[model samples]
Target: MTTILVTGGTGTLGRLVTERLRADGHEVRVLSRHSRPYAVDLRAGGAGLDAALAGVETVVHCASTPRGGDEQAARNLLAAAGRAGVDHLVYISIVGVDRVPFGYYRAKFAVERLVEESGLGWTVLRATQFHDLVVTLFEGLSKPPVMAVPAGVADQPVEVGEVAERLAELALSAPAGRVPDMAGPEVRPLDSLARAFLRATGRRRPVLRVPLLGKAYRAFREGGHLAPERAVGKVGFEEYLARRFGPDGGR
Candidate 1:
């Protein structure tokens, strides 16, 4: 059995990746800060990484920092993997992160560069925003019956499970430079999406428009977040809404 080590195994996508790998009869180990029945913190150096990484054929790095200064983390893990002689390293990133000028994007891009320079066989799977965006927009846009967001923003959020499955598949394959960037089937306008979320939650707030400055907003407003047609994931907006909001749309 191929032993696979997954960092951030406690997260949504990471947990799913670990669970799916185990289900497929692969020997899967989790990297986490918390101690669990199956957990190891990647941040801790060699002693922190357990025997799971020993004789491991692959390492799937799902752990990440949102803001800046993750180069050290990448260096540490890549260095560890390099020492371990791991066969492949798979990294999960965000779509349009290169195009967007956010701090987090900068950090992700930095990691991308690290992988390229690390000399270990590697693959990167850039994914679109998650369904969690729906819930996030609901909370961010609310202001006591009135909601506001980028006037002309657009998005194509995919399911987190889809991303997890893709990562699992990559872990089973030989190291490839970059995988197909995954996204949802439908390209959704932020305005309508926000309204749908509010309606789904049985909220009576009216969504308002607010334009953001610079390329950050323009990239989002101009369809920079949609996935290539060939790379579209199986799930779409309506299907996800129905699953989360129910037929009548309520808890």
Candidate 2:
């Protein structure tokens, strides 16, 4: 069994990927900023990183700072991996990052470039937004009776487990650059997704689709964040909500 080090192994997707990899009989080490067992901070690229990569054959880079500083972190990790002669580096990225104009998307795109040019054997899997993100968005906007959502925007929200499983599979295989994008089974409007969340959480709110004005929002409205041709995830938003909030939708 190969030893694998998973960056951002404590986060939502990272944790699931770590579990799946361990289940497959691989020795897994989780790298994070916090001082925990098997944790290494990617920002500190020194003895800590060297120790983390000592016997690791593969590196699954699931760590990302959407808010800021992702590119620097990626560079540090790539440099350390190259020095350690890592066999493969698998990067988990978002779908439509190249097309989207948001700052976070741009950062992710830059990191992708680093991995491609890092000279280490690498694989990049771009998946759509997760169900958890969708839920979190609605939860933040649930305070008012009239919930405002972006009109004309579409999303293909996939399950985190599906992404985790795919990451594990890719980490075990030969490094392939930029694999097929993974997306949810259905492509639904943002308004509809918000409505489903509201109904599931037993919230009595009128979801209003407001026309947003911004290049990023426009890109989203034009389906820049969608992968209609690559809808691989089996879990739909309704099914996901049903499982979480029950059949009656907690109403």
Candidate 3:
């Protein structure tokens, strides 16, 4: 069995990936800031990272912060992986990172570049936004009396479990650089998704579609973050909501 290390093993996607790898009979190590035995802070030069990488054949880099510090973490991981002689480095990225002008997307795109040129065997999978993220956004927007959503924006929210499954499969196979984009079954508008959340949560709120002025919003409106051609995901947002909130809108 291959020895694999998952960087954000406790996170939404990383946790599932780690479980999948271990279920497949591979030795899996979880490395997080607070995880035991290998609790190394990846953002700050990743001290003690060498110990974590020792004897590791593959690394699934799922540790990322939307606030900042992703590029630094990636650099530290790459350096450590190189020193440890890691066979493969798998990275997960967002689909619209290159097309969107958002700061977080820009940072993700930078990490993608680092993985490509790290001189190690690597694979990168760019997926659409996860359902959980969409739910979080809707939750935040729904807090106020009127939910204001960006006008004309659309998203294909893929299942995190499906993404984790794919990552596990990739980790076991040879490194194939930049595999096909994984997207949800439907390309849904933001307002529609917001409405779906309202229905699921049993909340009544007026949804406002405001046309925000920005390149990032423009890209979102133009569907830069969507992959209609690569809609390989089986689960849709409504089904996800049903599973998460139950039938009858979880009331």
lDDT of 1 by residue, 66-104 (tens): 644466677778888887899899999888878777778
Candidate of highest lDDT = 3
Query: 165 in model 3: Cα distance from truth in Å?
Result: 0.4
Error of 3 at 89 (Å): 0.2
Instruction: Write the residue-wise lDDT of candidate 3 on 1-251 in tens digits.
Output: 99999999999999999999999899999999999998988987555899999999999999999889999999999999999999999999999899999999999999999999999999999999999999999999999999999998888999999999999999999999999999999998899999999999999999999988988888888888889999999999999999999988888
Q: What TM-score, computed on C-alpha atoms, does each candidate reach?
A: 0.91, 0.97, 0.98
- Ordered list by TM-score, greatest first: 3, 2, 1
Candidates sorted by lDDT, best first: 3, 2, 1
The C-alpha RMSD of each candidate to the native structure, in angstroms, is 2.0, 1.2, 0.9
Candidate 3 lDDT score at position 182 = 94
Backbone collision count in every prediction? 1, 0, 0
User: Considering only N, C-alpha and C atoms within 3 Å, which residue pairs clash in candidate 1?
Assistant: 32-40
User: Stretches of candidate 3 above 4 Å error?
Assistant: none
Candidate 2, residue 175: the lDDT equals: 92
lDDT of 2 at 184: 94
lDDT of model 1 at position 116: 82
